[model samples]
Target: MNGPALFYDKAAFRKAGLQPPATWKELRQAAAKPTGGRSYGLALSAVATEEGSWQYVPFLGSGGDLEQLDSAESVSALTYWTSLLHDGSA
Candidate 1:
């Protein structure tokens, strides 16, 4: 599949003073913020659908060696996902 449109609501983001995060750590930390009376940081698509796989792209991309799915980086990605679930963030 091609993917969803890569558009950003610049006006809304500008109104919120949102800047592009420089690192993955920053992104995760930002996501962990409590807002709108919600406890979780971000929303994840766990449904067995195209969106679910799409949502997981970052982890897969971060694996460094896509040819080796069982690489340490891939394992780390899975671990992070599990951690999010255990901590009620996923």
Candidate 2:
């Protein structure tokens, strides 16, 4: 089956001279670059408890379990997201 897709702004990518990220690592690399001084590099929403949980699903899934968040995969996923915030990318 096909997975979900992230539709990026073609104009922003062109202005940034960046190609769409083919992997999570590539996304991390580009997440810190602003798009033409107009929009943020990335946008995330975790407004409240429910929404936060919903938004966290992907990161939790990357680690494999909702209960065991101490797993290496879980840590990696959280750390990656934290980096985005810390690096001012999101």
Question: Which candidate has the highest TM-score of all?
Answer: 2
Candidate 2 per-residue lDDT over residues 1-90, each given as its tens digit: 223336678887888889998777888777767623555787766577765656656655554566777788888888887888777777
lDDT of 1 by residue, 10-35 (tens): 55446546554566665555444432
Alpha-carbon lDDT of model 1: 0.58
Query: Which candidate number has the best lDDT?
Result: 2
User: At residue 86, what lDDT does model 1 achieve?
Assistant: 69
RMSD of 2: 3.2
Least lDDT summed over 10 consecutive residues: which range in candidate 1? 2-11
Candidate 1 residue 83 Cα shift, in angstroms, is 1.9
**What does the lDDT come to for candidate 2?**
0.71
Off by over 4 Å in 1: 2-20, 35-38, 64-67
How many Å off is the CA of 17 in candidate 2?
0.8
